[model samples]
Target chain A: MIKVYKELNNILLVNLNIKEASLENGDAFKAEVIKLFDKYHKSIAINMSAVEYIDSSFLGSIVSVFKHLISFQADVVLVGLSKDITNLFALTRLDKVFKIYNSFDEITNQ
Target chain B: MAQLASKQFLLPNTRQSIKASVQEVLDFVINSLPAGVNTEGISFKIEVIIIELLTNGIKHAGTIETFLDVTINEDNINIDKKDFGNRFHPGNITSLLVYDVGHKELLTKDGLHSMYAVVESDTQIRFVCEEENGDEVLDVSNLMEHFGLLIITKSSDTFTYEYDVDTGLNTFSVIIDLN
Candidate 1:
């Protein structure tokens, strides 16, 4: 199982072990991300410091989780987005949708 | 060990040299593979898939002072190509999110850009490719400039990419069922 740690606020840090975070762990990953939404009414911060490759299914999972959180007026932020990962997000126009940060410090300050 | 697979290659340090390198290995795999498999769509698929991975590494992974390790087995294949330069930053890995299956609402008129162009099935070769009259001449050596991202996804039943920055090494693997 991938590591999921909930922080002081509604901060959810998901540390993926591999550089490529695609559909291999799609359902379980979705479930973990959604679990944060279901429990935390505060802001949700996803720390993707360890991931490198996130494919379409992985993007959908993130979007699906965001939808659930937004319904509850929650905020979501993604941290440590790599150049390649950020490019893909930008390509899909998801860069506008996601609150991406270079590091945890950038988001934690906000 | 019952599960023993190996891929030994003498990878020269130039971009042009990799074409023969990729094709030779693909040919070896094609020739040595189990028979009666339809490689119709997949035959074209290999061009995109192989080039994307190999070229990306050649272009970005930077230095070339090492060998590539490729492992093929019954279930999956593991391809590890490392240059082991000073810049292999283990901490900063590039993550890309491409969609193989599409969203009902977000369909692009140009099919190549769409990630959802693929179908879901664990079996194998569940990819969809539109009729493309591409450039007549193609060099796997210069793949990034020519090939679209869709080829990589369409070529395999499953694909994964990883590059270790600390190690300055990149690895990509594709698993397909020719049966």
Candidate 2:
């Protein structure tokens, strides 16, 4: 469900290659990202362009990752969220907690 | 106003099954809509409602089988779910608050967007969204876990849960008003 696209300037770029992020793959997704974060010890940017929908279980895993990274003073950002997905974040009030970018270029260029 | 479509599905209490069932229901709801209806807004909300309802049964209630009923009306959508699982413990819920995160305040009442939890008895608890209002701050600090119920209540116009002790049945009714 996740692909390690590349690492640029110490920032890990990962792509979530799933149309729906739910309980079925949430645990695996969390473990993969945790492993990547442990190995790199750097900031991570998750590209969620492929995710059309997400359930609470899946969103919980993302929250876990954010809390984990925040504890260490590292950063975790999201990019390429669909309008509905963006609405989901806003609904949960997580839009204030996570740094979300409209596109990959926005993060890469900055 | 008028009934447009109605369907039901019996699914096992597994993550994979729940995920697939949600997709199937979304497809059915979309396909059954009238020709001029735009599903861009309501599709995601329906997916969230079903996923949360089924996930709750599997995770907390240890349910083996979940039955889902989807009824789409002219002005709203109603989802009815049933399963035999452990009774709910409403005492564990510390607080139930629906905040408009964008505006940084609680929403009192809107079209199908009121939220509150009521404990009728030891064997019965209801989460109703009718005409209640609050002015609490938008706090997401301790909302990491056990928020499936919140998501369901927030997404739907009205959500009511009733567990029958006599028959050991848990019934969850959710209604989403369309714009």
Candidate 3:
């Protein structure tokens, strides 16, 4: 469900290869991401370019991971969101809290 | 607006089942629309609405039967969802609650600028989010993750919930304008 693209400057880039991100895999997704964070202790950039739909449960899991990473001074940023998906983030006002980018290279280059 | 298509679905109280049903519902709506009718926006809204409806049902209602009716009209899409679970306590949510990074507080309307619940009547409650058009930012965090009702209300033109005492049915009706 998730593929690790690379680790650059202690920043981890992971890609979610799922069409729908919802309650079905919410817990597992959170666990997997948390495990990665624990092992690498690096800031993570999630590329959600393939996720067409997402629900509050999955969103909650994302928030949970963010809370866990914050204590370690790590953050979770999103990249490559579709228009409607971007609207969803804006709708819930998460765009203000999370650093969202248009592409994976934006984060790696920065 | 005339009814273009209508269908009902009985889904299991599981995320996988409900997720699959939402896809079916979205596909049905897409096939029902006339040629050249742009559905890019409405389709996304409908997907969010249906997922929220069934997931909320399962989360609150437990192992109860759930049914969703999708009716597509000329200018609107109507979704009626029913779950035989516990009754929702809208009155319990009294104040305008807002949460930020490290804390949450209950404030009056003047102090807050985001979504809150309002008890419209004995059997109905309307969620007053930031904007009816759903374009404005909610100015709140999703940390609570209690956004199912708020999301449904903001995504639809009209959103209402009713509990039938005799039938013991909790019904959520939503209408999305197709214009």
Candidate 4:
């Protein structure tokens, strides 16, 4: 299941709990991400600590959400990561794409 | 530094073969790294690099006989792929290395391109176009979109690009710091 919450008008927090962020989940998640972006006036932050695995289509989903938010001058931040996941980011050069922080405090402080 | 065992696999430069090989390669190493991490970022970058490099090897290197080698030990991975289709002019056997040092300073371009998208228990990430390589090969399509290498910049924490026009192959390497 994918959870979306809004905080402080500018913050949108997304929590995903699933083995794979596959097509079914992606469709549902996409709809909500759009909704949250439209309703909020601040940047969005997606909490991915629960996500165990991600694929190409999944990556695209996140990129789309970020692109959507950035067009509105809002940004998304990622916090906490495991090594394998980090390797994927590095391999795809996606490590260069997103704004990732070590902890929740890092994202909040930034 | 966790003792990372280095393993190399070489195969004929084929598109189908390369993609499958890459998936298998990542599965073993990535699984052993950590749990809370998001697979999204790595999957994306791995797809891009594997596709581009394998395609290049099949098309440019013409190494139907020699195998592409990927060496992994911990965060540092060195992919040494040799091809005969070298744009190196002579059509002799050429060698290229795709290296992912897995260090910091991933984005060699500017802005946040070096920051890779990661998914953990608390942190979710969004890969932006602003963080990209100074020299983007995939940029042939969009002002920001890269044909091959650009896709990878968004997948990791560090970036290293080395291509000898003298040799027929190009290697795009990236290093991501997993928190």
Q: Scoring each candidate complex against the real one, what DockQ results?
A: 0.01, 0.42, 0.49, 0.06
Q: What CAPRI-style quality would you assign to candidate 2?
A: acceptable
Count backbone overlaps in model 2. 0
Q: What is the Cα-based TM-score of model 2?
A: 0.78
Best-matching candidate per DockQ:
3
Candidate 3 docking category?
Answer: acceptable
Candidate 2 structure lDDT: 0.75
Question: What lDDT does the true structure give each of the candidates?
Answer: 0.51, 0.75, 0.76, 0.52
Q: What is candidate 1's lDDT per residue for B21-78, written digit by digit as tens?
A: 6676677555543345554443444534554555555545565533656555554444
Give the Cα RMSD of candidate 4: 12.6
What digit string (tens of lDDT, one per residue) describes model 4 on residues A1-110?
Answer: 65764375457666656655533366677677778777766776777777665544456566667667767778777656656556656645666667876666665566
The best candidate in terms of TM-score: 3
Q: What TM-score does each prediction get for chain A alone?
A: 0.83, 0.95, 0.96, 0.82
> What i-RMS does every model get?
13.8, 3.9, 3.0, 7.5
Ranking by lDDT: 3, 2, 4, 1
TM-score of chain B of each: 0.54, 0.73, 0.76, 0.51
- Per-residue lDDT for B21-127 in model 2, tens only? 88899999998876666687788788778888888887778877888888988888889888888765443543222222122123233222344565544444456
Q: Candidate 2: which pairs clash?
A: none
